[model samples]
Target chain A: MQPDDLSRHLAPILGDRLIAVEPFPETAGRVRFRREGALDLFRAMRDDLGFRHFSTVAGIDWVDHREAVYVLWSDDAKQYVLLSVDLPAGDPRIESASGIWPSANWHEREAWEMVDLNFDHHPDLRHLLMPDGYTFHPLLRSFKLHEPEELEVKARHV
Target chain B: MSEMWINMGPQHPMTHGLWNLRVKLDGEIVVDVDPEIGYLHRGIEKISEDRHYNEVITLMDRCCYVAGFSWEHLYILAAEEALHLAPPERAEYLRVLCDEFQRIGSHLMWYAAFVQDIGLMSPFLYGMRDRDLVLDLYQSYTGARMTYEYMRVGGVRNDLPPGFSAEARQVLDWLSRRFDEYDQLTLGSDIFRKRCDNLGILKANDCVAHGVTGPMLRSAGVKRDLRKDRPYSAYDRVEFDVAVADGADVTARYLVRLEEMRQAVRILRQVLDWLDKNPGPVMAEELPRWLGAPYAPIGREGYLLKRNFPKGVGFSAVEEPHGEAVAYVVNEGGEHPYRVKFRSPVFSNISAARKYLIGYHVADIPPIMGSVDICIGEVDR
Candidate 1:
C-alpha cells in the first residue's frame, strides 16, 4: 500500500475533496483531504479499505491553521495509513470520526481539550486530561510554559 | 434495587494508580462505568515542545515508569526518523535487549499487583522478588532502576558494561525457573481460577474496535504482535512466538502475559548471544556536534547547528509492555520539535472500560481491571 495505491483507491470515493496522497515514512501514505469529506473518508477507510483498527487521533497546531491526523491500521494490509485534514485556525471544526470508529472517542476528546480543535457532534465533548472549567488549550503555541497564569478549576460531580 | 454510582479510585488498591472508576451499579451487578482520568496528567506532550530533541528522553522515562526504556526507545525512533538519522546495528540490538528485559520487568510488576488483586498474596511477594533481579541488571548498566535515560536520539548513551551479559543470563535462568512456580501458585490454586476464569472477557472484535492491544488483545487469540506484524529495530532478527489465547478472559490474559514473558526470555537469549558475538559502535557517527556528544549541555549551540537540518515528520509505534505506544515527532528546522504527540495504549484500553466493566458483579472489578494492566502514568500523560 503506497501513496499511488491510496490515491488510486480513495480518489473515486472522495473525488476532488480528496487532496494529494503523499508518501509518509513507515506507513502507506498520508491522506490529505478536505474537512467536508471527513466522515465519508472515515467510512470508506473502515468499511471499504478494511482498516478495522483505528489507532489514534492527534491534533497539531500550525498557528495559522490546525491539523488533525487520524492513524488507522488494516489487519489485512499489516500497514498503517494516516489521514490528515487542515482546518482554519479561527474556527477549527470538523466532523468527528467517533461514529465510524468508537476508538476515536477519547482521542477526539483529548484533541479538543488540548489543541482546541472542535470535533463537531463528538459525544461527550468535554475535558479529558484537563480539569473541568479549564479554559486554556495548553498545546497551542501561544500557551507559554515560562509564564505563570491564574487558574480556576471547579471540582467534578461535587 | 436502585442504581447508584460509586467511585472506585483516586486511591484504590485495584486502581494501581491515580484515577477514578465511577461504576453505576444495581445492587451487586454493574450497570455502567465512566472512568475519570487526568489525576496523573503532566502534559508530557506540551512539555516536549520546549525541550531539545535529546532532552525529551528524560520525560519519556517518566512517561511510563515501569516501561521507561520502551518509551525512551519509542521517542528515540521517532526523533531519529524526523532528523533523518539511524542508529548503528549494535545500538539496535542493545535497544532490543532493553525492550525485552523491560517487558519482563513490567509483566512481573503487573503479575505482582494482579495476583494481589485476586486475593493471592504470596505471589505478589514472589513476583516482586523476581522483578528486583531484572532491575538489578538495569541498575548495573543504565545506572537507574526505573528512569533510565540511556537512549539518545540517534543511539543509546553507552554500551553494556563488561560481564553484563553473563549476569543477565543468570537472572534470565532464574526467571525461567520461577515462571513455572508462578503457574503452580496461580493456575493450580482454586481461588485464583474461580475468581479469574471467564471474567472480563473482551473478545477479539471488541478488543480491535476499542483499540485494545498488548496482552488484553492477544488474549482474544489475535496474532497481532507489532513486533511480528511490523518489525522494528532488531525485532526482525530475533526469533520468538506471538503469545495468543482464545479464552479472552482474565485467565486468557494471564496466559498471554505468561507466554509473553517466556518469549521475552527467548528474545533476550538471542539478543545476548548476538551482543556477545559482535562488538561495534553503539552511537551513530555523522551526527551533529550537539547531539553527538553524550553529555552535551542544552545550549544555543544546538539551535545554531540545527538551522540547516532537514525537516520531516516521524511516526513510530512500539509494542509497549502495556500495549502499542506511538510517538509522532515533527521537525521544522528547529532545535526543539514543533509538536510531539503520543498515543498511549492504556488510554484506549481504559476508555473501553464501560464495554467490559458493565454487566459484571461489583466484586469482580479488581480482577477485571487487573487483567487490563492499567498504567495511569502513560494513560494521563
Candidate 2:
C-alpha cells in the first residue's frame, strides 16, 4: 500500500502516540512513534499492516537522546516502512520488538551492546559483537578510541 | 552414549571463517548448536563514525572479501542518500556492472568452499579458477583484486577504461560455459546428491522469521529479492528473473546459487550493453570540497563543520551475493557519519542455526553452513 494506507491503519490505534507517517521516497513511508506505544504499534504494523518480514533494528546515539530504528517489509505491499522510536540518553529503554518479530532477536542484541539501548523484555539480550565482560559501549559518542596498543589477552582455562 | 558439546570452529575444517560453532551431539546426530561470533569483529561500525564519507569505502572492502564491490555499492547508495547526492546515469550502470561481476565471483568462491566441504575436490579448484577470471576483470578496471576502493560517494571514482566492456563480455561468456561444467561436476555426482538432498531444510516461514535472505530464502520458495521487489540502483532498468527453488535444503540452495550465477551473467550483459552506448561523468559535480578529495588536506577552516551539508539518515538495502545486506548511515551534518549499522545477512542466517541444525546429522553441518556462505568479516563488522 501507500503512505496514506499506513496512516489510516495506524491513526485510530496509536492516537497521539503515533508521531507521523510521512511519505519517504524509495520506501512506502517512515512511521515515527513514541516509545510508550512501541508494542501496540509493532503488533499493529505486523498483523494489521501485513509487514511480517522484519529486516533490522539499529540503535543510534544522538548524544542528547537515543534512537532505535526498526525496518519492516511487507510482502503484500512490496514496500518497506521504517519505524523509529526515540528514548532518553541516560536510560535508553524501549519495549523489545523481538516479541512481535523473531528476527529482532539478533538485531536487538547487537543494538543493545553497541549503542547501549536496552531492549526491555528481550528474550536473550547479550553481547553480540563484544566479548563477554566487555565494559564499554563503543558506538556511543563518549567512548573515545585511540591508536591500537599491544596488550596481553588472558587465555581462559578449560 | 550421552549427549556432549563439540566446538567445530575458532579453527575447524568445517568452518570457513574465524568463528566457533558449538554443537551438542547425541551419537552423531546434532542435539543443538550455538554459534559464537565476534572473533573476527574489528568494530567497523564504530570505526566508520571517525572517518570521512568516502574513506569508509576502504572498510567496505574488508566487509566481505568475495563481495567487496557489492558492499562498496551498498555503502555508497546509503552515503549518497544521506548526503543528498545523485550519481550520473553511466555511474549507475557501472555500479550494476560491479554488482553482477561480484555476484559471479562470490558464488564461485561459495561453490569452491561448499564443494570442498563435501569432499568434491576437482570442482573446488575449478570454482577458484573461474573466480580468478572475475577477479582479473576487477583488477583491470578497479586496479585492485580484492579491496578496490573504486566507488565514491555520489558516484564512482572513474569511468570504465577503453575496451573494458569487451573484456567483461568475454569473461561473462566464459563463466556461462563454466556454469554447465560446474553443474555437471556437482549435480551430476551421485554422492553430491546423496549428501545434499533433503539436508538442512529450513522452511519458508522459518526463513522469513529468522530474517534469512539471498539464496537461502530463495531456496525456500520465497521470491523476496530486493532487486525485483524493491529495485534499487540500476536493477530497475535491467530485466532479470529472481532465482528461486522450493526444496529449502542443501541441494536446493546449490541450485539457487547456480541459477543466480547465470542470472548475474544475464544482468552483466545488459549492463555492459548500456555502458557501451552511454559515456558520462562518474562523480557528481555538486559535491562539497572535502568529499571531492577524501584524503587531501583542506584549508585551516575544516569542512567537517560545514553548515551547508544537509543532515539526514540514509537506509540502503542491496541484494548482495550472500543475501540482502542493509546499510544505515546517519549523517547528522558532519563529514563523519554519526552512526553506521550494517545488517549482514549471514549474521541472521547463522542466528537461526538452532532452528535448522538441531535435528540434522552432525556430519551435515559443513555443507549446510557452507551453503549459507559464511563471511565472518561482514558477520562481525
Who wins the lDDT comparison?
Answer: 1
DockQ of each: 0.87, 0.78
Docking class of 2: medium
Chain B TM-score list for all models: 0.98, 0.96
Residue B337 lDDT (model 2): 90
Q: How many collisions between residues are there in candidate 2?
A: 0
Off by over 4 Å in 1: B298-307
Residues B196-296 of candidate 2: C-alpha lDDT, one tens digit per residue: 99999999999888888889999999998999988888899999999999999999999999999999999999888888887778777787666663332
Per-model RMSD to reference = 1.1, 2.2
* Winning candidate number (DockQ): 1
Fraction of native contacts, model 1: 0.79
lDDT of 1 by residue, B335-376 (tens): 889999999999999999988888999999999999999888
Per-residue lDDT, model 1, residue B127, is 98
Docking tier of model 1: it is high
Q: What TM-score fits each model?
A: 0.98, 0.96
